[model samples]
Target: MVKKKKGRSVKKNPNVNLESEELTQAPHSFIIQRGLGHGHIVELTRDFRKLMEPFTAKSLQEHKKNTIKDFVSVAGLLHVTHLCIFSQTEVGMYFKVGRLPKGPTLTFKVQNFSLAKDVVSSLKKQLVVEKAFKRSPLIVLNSFNSDTAHMKLMASMFQNMFPKINLTNVDLNNIRRCVLLNYNPATDLIDFRHYVIKIVPVGVSKGVKKVIQGKIPDLSKCNDISEFFTRAAILSESEMEDDPNSHITVNQKLVSRGNVEQGQSAIKLTELGPRMTLQLMKVEDGLLDGIVLYHHHIHKSEEEKLEIQKKRDSKRKLKEKRKQVQEANKKRKEAEREESKQKSLKGMPKSTVDKDSVEERDDDVQYYREEVGAEPDKDLFLDNNQTKNDVSKVLRKFKKKKNENFCKNKEDKFERNKQKFGVKRTTQFKQNKSRVRNRLVGKTFNKKSNVKRKSK
Candidate 1:
């Protein structure tokens, strides 16, 4: 038999936690800001309302209201204009609060000026790439939400222009025709490109706001307005990528939902009560069309843990069953061994032969004594009482039987002789008579012969 190595097998706990501690940390940010441009903000808000209307149809309107309120609470209105107000400030001095998703939320003193400069340069690239000189305003998309195929094609086209980039998260939004790029000097950030288009309010004069709003702002120029904001907002977002500990902050408003507490940059009890907590986190790069952020829990792997536990329990049960079967077999083997011993002991001469031999000897002695006592001639019969009696009885029976047999044989012989020949008694009488007659004749003849001789 080959000897097995006595190495211990390590068993893993399936319930071991897979979620990182980074998920537990709430979103932290250097600043908090609300968007400006109240009318556009309201329009965005209306868009959110329309999105949530469908969700409310499934339940009491309160459900939808809570969701909206929660998103606003965590992401802080989720209005791009509001977020822009903070972007206007210098890069270092933090002001507004930002929500982080899967990563950590951090508070940092703005340490680098190049980070701000990079943001501006990233935005400038958008206009140049889109070729904004044309009438049909170009559309720019952030690398975050770009489709893989399109991203790859774009990457190939721009291989000589820029480094390789991944566009796995992209999907075409309401706007079309865009360039996606990753441009972050401090932290790698996704960016979208197009000529900056600004929507001028009905009342505002054509000045700095108008200049920022761009040349043409109208329904026909809606696409342009979208592209302009896409570039302007590029610099607004400040994400910390160096700190594996840091996460991007975002608002839930774009998706038209409430704030999340578990994975967001900040964790806070809702105004409603302790029943729920509001969470805020960034979902994607700022230049991406969709709002950045989500609300979810740091969920535990419950099902896997239960499955592991069940497996262990089943293995234990199987082991116990096998042990029971082995024990029963052992008992049965022992019982068989015991039974075999009993069988061997049963035929032992000590009990079957010796035990009975002793009894039989004693019985023989008693039988002899009884025979002696029963006999009348005790002295003569003592030595061979049984043998003598047997012999005498046999002789007497033989003599009596022999006499009976002789009589029967003589009768049978006489009967057979009478049948075979006539009687002999009359023969003797006839013979005597003949002899007397013959004697008489001879005497007469003799007298006659004497007389004749005298006469001569």
Candidate 2:
């Protein structure tokens, strides 16, 4: 082998142990001068395979432990087109992400102003990018704000952002250019000859200074504008122009003076007397002619007149008969009512005997017999002094007692027959029972009672 240099030999085996040497070594001049400053050198010892190892195992139990807490499944990103900010408070800002047809709406709560701003900016950028990439037309409609100046400002901003797209107002079609025609009120008729004509180019100002300084006049006061403009336009053309070629004029002179001859006579008052006589003769002649032409005309005979009188008399008699029948029916109804009252009263007690009256009568009879030491007359004892007030009081008491007895009997019958009839009784059964009871009571009073005749 060739002999190598000592320096080369030492450099070739640079990994040789140096701790065994006793000589002290000084720090590097670069490190001392920079005072712990390191050069801009980066070291990368990344193992991408080792980093992604946890995500590689799909069925790993430990990885599955990291569950999603609050997750919302987005059906489609395009459908989430509307972003509405509902509220902004100290705690957080609330907003909804939704669209028409009202599908799933996602509400987001952003914590800070900076974060909300960033999120809104990102959303706008995404929307713009999506619109551009898809090449879809966008229509912006605003109805919440009515200020025209604010609307114009918004329109300018939108135009600046979407330079390639067409921007128009929602009511663009409704905007109209109304040209008010000048009117001359001095003339009663519409004067078309002196109309002030104006032709304004689209998007060009006639007088910019005047427009800026002038106020918008009320259109309600300009009713004659349409009529004036129409009349002016129609009458300004050749159709209304006077033409000498179509004009015609005539002139005439009398040939001769007519002579007044004495052949024809003028009408006089004296002639009217003979004319009236002739007219009277003509009227009489006309009447005679009419009578002769209609000779077969018939006239009413005496027998026919008599027959008409008889028919009138018969109609009067029929009306009187009908009135008499109606009167008889009314009287019969009154008599039937009286009879019904009498029948109803016949069943009621004639004289009511109250408990106090009965006791007083008994005490009076006993006192009279004891004091007189003889039996009192039966007729005098039985007869009590009766007055109109006493009769009314007796009637009232009798009515009350009858009503109480009737109600008690009705309730007792209903209770007794309620079980015999099933669980319920129909209205027909109750009505039939009432009708049968009324008929039986009416028949009971009609029966004649047997009485033994005493020997005279």
Candidate 3:
């Protein structure tokens, strides 16, 4: 039996990285539906991620336990510029686009939306390809020329979501997708759609175009080559009727052949959608919070606005005062630490002064050493090795001197008694001399207790 060879694994290319100068400067965002999410909203977030494409965090897997702050905290390090949050409520689905760190957030009520899979399923042919999303989609805005401040801001934000193109040096082949934002003044609603760009030959029939495209269609149903031209329905069902508005003569070559000629090329767009219809509900001055700049549903009186502003000012001032107090305390602690450290270092070299004070009484020993040049008597010095000189060590030295005198006197008396009493009396005197120290200590204790001892 022959062994089958294992197929080689194909590694997917990494997403647009940090080293790319153009991508780093461009606005990047995360489509987040953190915390709890409903079924439609979770799927909606997934579909919207596709619309963001290679520049955005395409592989960001958010947990229900995760929070907005978790993403916000790291957004600056990753150079993320914007945050898109989708949430569903009992009334409707809401979408928020907030600038990172500090933000003027735009909140929209999602009137309706269709997912990408649903859009593709409705079409006769699916044009969703991995190659189409390799580069960011071109953004085209319509009816955004209104003088309203919010409208201008919305237009600017939408434009910045996609990277800027330098048409002079940009490759035509990489321009594969586009996003269209059409605003309607009548409804005050925005229609958002994504599209895949395709350039096809206008003059040629579907059969010849297919041959040029290198896709060989089935010929079993066709009787002859002429039948392909004669039969109107025999061409692919996915083929769309050519629109005159879509046709444009190309000045340069394209990725596809036969569409490069000046008169032959036509640009067609297929809906690559997760289509959205949104109505701006509110606009905030900060990241999802702060002062409300505009609100479609709310109106406040002049007095109320003034009162709110005064309260906010008071709170801000109080916070700043507390911060100053904390800073002052921190500086005080650091100063104290430095002071203690300096005091310790300055006091480190005073050991010589301490030694001189401890041995003040030993001046005689030093004088003899210098003048006599002889070894001093060991008995003259006190044994104070373990600790400083104490009363106990002094008493011990006095007792040794006293005992020496007592021993000499007793020996002389015992020698006199021994000469008169003979050898037995001499042995008894020797034993008494051995116990003389113990007998002296007992006699002192007996005198303190007022007791008499019979001494022989």
**Number of the top candidate by TM-score?**
3
User: Where does model 1 exceed 4 Å of error?
Assistant: 1-300, 342-346, 371-456
* Model 2 C-alpha lDDT per residue in residues 310-406, reported as the tens digit of each score: 8867988999999999999999999999999999888755456455567787899999988999888855544345555577888999999999999
State the displacement of the C-alpha of residue 133, model 1, in Å, after optimal TM-score superposition. 66
Segments of candidate 2 deviating more than 4 angstroms: 1-299, 342-347, 350-456
**Greater-TM-score candidate between 2 and 3:** 3
Error of 2 at 442 (Å): 65
Candidate 1 vs 3: which has more TM-score:
3
lDDT of 3 by residue, 342-413 (tens): 998888566776686557647868987899899688756543442445676778889998999999999988
Give the per-residue lDDT of model 1 (tens digit) for 1-456.
Answer: 999877653445554554344322212111222333232322322322222221111121222224322433444222211111121233222212222222112111222222222333545332222222222222233443344432343333233222122355432121122233343323433232322331112222223233544545443433655464444433333421123233323322222122232223321111100010111212222221222222123333767657756886798899999999999999999999999999988766655665576676567667777887752434332324456788899999999999999999998887776566534634555656776787788833334333444564
How many clashes show up per model?
Answer: 34, 0, 0
TM-score to true structure, per model: 0.16, 0.14, 0.70
All models, RMSD in angstroms: 38.6, 53.1, 17.8
